[model samples]
Target: MDLEFMEAHLPLYIEAAVLTLRIAAAGILLAFLTGLITSIIKYLKIPVLMQIVNAYIELSRNTPLLIQLFFLYFGLPKLGVVLSSESCAIIGLAFLGGSYMSEAFRSGLDNVAEIQTQSGLSLGFTRSQIFRHITLPQAVSTSVPLFCANIIFLIKETSVFSAVALADLMFVAKDLIGIYYKTDEALFMLVSAYLVILLPISVIASFVERKVRYAGFGDTSTVSG
Candidate 1:
């Protein structure tokens, strides 16, 4: 291991780490919004839209993210829809992450008991009112752990953006290996950087999950006739 070389390149690694964080943060945000919107559309069973959303999720989940990034960055340009590498990385990450995130949200929403909806309806509440007042909170509580897990996964997966030449941590490490011939040191630091970034996220997610479990999704007591 070339400790001197590693020390000299520390600034490069730090810059790469910052860029990786920005990309991951932006990608996860996009994924959350996309997943939320798609899950709601699916939940509502909106005609035509539901089919499209399902198809999107199926295609995204089934395919490799590399192929997706290539299609966005390389393939789209053939049709005159040019996108920069960074944009391609963000969109690709969002597409892949959103599919899984949608499933998590849909599962959470499903976990909300039908009885809760029925009780609200019996009280003359509108469908929207029941969802807003009764279903959404419990669903969110149940979903928090899964949502956090997906974010962790997405953060780790941001390493893939390096394949597209996006200058993420992995890309910088790759460059260092090529330039300094210090493969062990470069790879070791790369792994350490990711651990630094992902470990806290995992811990926080577990803590939130435990809190949600103890908090009770909502009152599950049966409604008396």
Candidate 2:
């Protein structure tokens, strides 16, 4: 298994893990923000903007992430729009994750009962106030678990960043295998790293989902199509 070689390269792998986390974290943040904005626009049925958002969601969700990354990393340069590999990876992942997260957010927004909005309006609440005080809370509660799951998916999906030669966990593992020819050890470490990060997240999401469901925030039938 080339234990000595692994030990010698442990620091490099750790650095790669850190980079992976950085990219994933940044991409997730971007995705959440993008998702929320688009979801809200769609929820409000804002004319041209809604069409644009829908188009983006359809295109991003329907396409492979690898193609998106390649377009940004390679295709853009042909048009003189150069981007670094890291930039391409982060943007690609964010767009891909945002598309899915937007759906989750849309589901949550849809779950907020129409009567709740009407009641808030009857009580003299403006639309914005109603949304801020009533609809948003319920929507967020209902959507939190799905949102968490989406984040975990993106975390794993970050491995694809290696295709662009970005030095993330998968890339580092592949590099180590190339150098030491210790395929088993490299794959083990790669899988272990992902499990270590993802297991706790999945557990926490499950616990939170149960609590939210028990608290009546989750009613699967009300979730959007």
Worst 10 residues of 2 by lDDT: 215-224
Best model number under lDDT = 1
Alpha-carbon lDDT, every model: 0.87, 0.86
Candidate 1 residue lDDT tens string, 40-133: 9999999999999999999999999889998898899999999999999899989998998899889878877777888899999999999888
Query: Cα lDDT of model 1 overall?
Result: 0.87
Look at candidate 1 and give me any clashing residue pairs.
Answer: none
lDDT of 2 by residue, 83-133 (tens): 998889889989999988999999888887677788899999998999899
**Stretches > 4 Å off in candidate 2:** 211-225
Quantify how close model 2 is to the true structure by its C-alpha RMSD in Å. Answer: 2.5
| Residue-pair clashes per candidate | 0, 0
Best by TM-score: 1
RMSD of 1: 2.8
Instruction: Give model 1's TM-score versus the native structure.
Output: 0.93
